[model samples]
Target: MRTQALGGRPRQPRGGVPFMLLLAVLVSPAALAQGASRGARLFAQRCGTCHSVGEGDRVGPDLHGVLERRDEAWLTRFLESPGALIDAGDPVATALLKQFNGIRMPDQPLSEEERAGLYTFFRECTAKGKGSCKPSPTQKPGTDATPEEVALGRRLFEGTEALAQGGPSCLGCHDVRGTGVAGGGTLGPNLTFTFARHGDRGLTPLLAKLDTPLMRELYAKAPLTEEEQYALKAYLADASRDGSRPRKDRDFFFLGVVGLLAALGFIGLVWGPRGTDPRAH
Candidate 1:
């Protein structure tokens, strides 16, 4: 356990192993801090051109909702050797190769810690439900709703149609924003956050499924109109996470200049009357 130190004097730092372990433990957090879970910035800088979790669907298939969808064991193996996975006929890996137009995602040799951090980034993305990091209000439909469209979209989502009609409204099966129905009969993922989760493109396709062979027995019979689509899109957009960054964080010095002008006007209003009254009143 001893090593020669300074003038070749014997030293037992940690009795050797304990010191090494302690140093390892001490340096671990700093290493993690420098890793990707700090945010997607590094991953994006180094990897984003070919990948995304926002479901934007660029050169790669949308990585947005993939954590639960892809197997971690498979992810680790594939990261180590993507070509092997493609040749082995791993369904997802094979599909990814074909979907990206046969362009192979290069094998990036990641340390175990780096791979773990990337996994963390994946989980964080899904955790941030449509973007609100702050404790904001429930995301609501805005872009998809014109003043006219909100009511219609809400009605269809909530299933308020007369009960005598037999067929329950859209909420009977698919869930959308503002549907008060509880446990929502689990044929689809819960919509309490769907709108916020899937904006327009992602949500639209599923709505169209209402009449598909699979959903026809349950969802497709109910046709949502074009206008209904717009409203629903609006609802989803509004219910979305706070995608907008804070205004104060942007440019408030301009606001300060304007506020100074308003203060001058207020001073004029108060002083002008008193000073003028002495002579002109």
Candidate 2:
């Protein structure tokens, strides 16, 4: 007679695997795909600023076939806190820092599940072949953009047209040459050559997230709409290209000087000379 288990089922003949262990081994392919999808989105949003998969080096090195080069445990530790690895003088991490012009990778705090997903994503990319995985293509506002789109971009940049999301206009913070007589605000850096400096890859992610401290604070609630982003990007690209040509900035300067003098003259007429009363004279 077979021995009965607590649930009235026959016991295993010898050493059998437990039910919980069997269930743990049975993950569906759909579940794995979902994790990989999440990882891809996260990478595009966060890592794409500094790194790419198969594309050549950006701010950081290309991560294609990174798994084959570094062990998973070491990669995990490095991802958790690169600065720590650098501080501890890990040979590989130190070499990476030196190779990348000493720009230390920022710590990426990811939960185990998220990390596992990233590993899956990386493995999938590696399996495809060298340089097989590429960043998702972003819409570039290049010379191909129509004149109308460029005009809309100018309007949006100069705040002549309101942003759909009611976010602060670019002119309020950034200065772009040829915008107007006064130009743009001085609080932020001049954006005349921004496109030339960052190019499409860098600018796309920056615009998508606006992840800088000040920008995040300002645009956390009021984000730019897709149309607004495109228009603004187009305008900036145009501005960068046009920066090479000579502009009539001297005329604007003279006009501002004349305006200032007129304002002073009007003030004098209204208030008269200081320390002298019209009634006394």
Candidate 3:
């Protein structure tokens, strides 16, 4: 004769809770690795152009031990809205702006999960030390360009250094601030802030394909070399930094004035003048 429970089921094993806890401990590293992997991809897509982990600062400060330096709450808030923090005059944000030459870090659009993943990646990089946080192949280089390399890039863009394939220089169609007396051409969009606008993710592809209507025809036979591409990227990055500072864009100013006058004229034609009442009695 044996005693039996009402439902005739045996009780769960006594060690089950401990076993599950052990399993969780074993699985955590893999989970972290997965998160870090996702973080690496997101970083390359979003932050790799301007920031580095252990390799020292680029456009932004090196983030080797960012977690150690800043608390999680602050990092989360700052990442969510760097511009707002700067505008609010947070000391750290203001100092970072000054440190990075007034190039404001744009606010990132990241879900909570994505932000967690980035944190995991930052932790992984910090644990691994310098040179361990390698950028993926898609990340363009020359972010750590030397001054000489930047100068060479400027020369190339301005046609001071002739292209080996005889392709037209970048200056013919584009403009940048601080180019000498002649300045740059106006055929293409002003390139003063091109790097900031596009980042490496946008820029690398554009350069590699040269697929814009005009660029396609011009560089179809004269493709840029890898070295040339890197050089030009360095120059554009430098110019982008300058564009962050206050400066005048003559073309933009003129166009703005024209637009303002046109708007004023249209308003006048539609409603008479500023103080005129159009109410029907």
State the TM-score for model 1: 0.34
What is candidate 1's lDDT per residue for 1-281, written digit by digit as tens? 01001112123333345433543453344344433333354455446666657646677666666668778897799888888889889988888888789988777677887677777877777788543222111122245256556665566566653322233555544443335646233333334344443343335544534332334454344555545555655554444432432133212223322333343344453236555654445
Which candidate ranks first by TM-score, i.e. highest? 3
Tens-place lDDT per residue, model 2, 1-281, is: 11111112223333233432332232222234343366675676678789889877988999888889999999999989999999999999999999999998888788987888788878988888767666543354344467887898889888889878787777866667789559876545466656665564445556655644446677878887766677777777777776342234343233333443343444454246655745455
Predict model 1's lDDT versus the native.
0.50
Tell me the deviation in Å of residue 94 in model 2: 51
TM-score of 2: 0.40
Better of 1 and 2 by lDDT: 2
Q: Which candidate model has the greater lDDT, 2 or 3? A: 3
Query: TM-score for all predictions?
Result: 0.34, 0.40, 0.42
The per-residue C-alpha lDDT of model 1 at residue 144 equals 26
Q: After aligning candidate 3 to the native by TM-score, how far in Å is the CA of 86 from where it should be? A: 44
Best-to-worst lDDT order: 3, 2, 1
Residue-level lDDT tens digits of model 3 in 239-259? 776523325444443433343
How much lDDT does each candidate structure score?
0.50, 0.65, 0.69
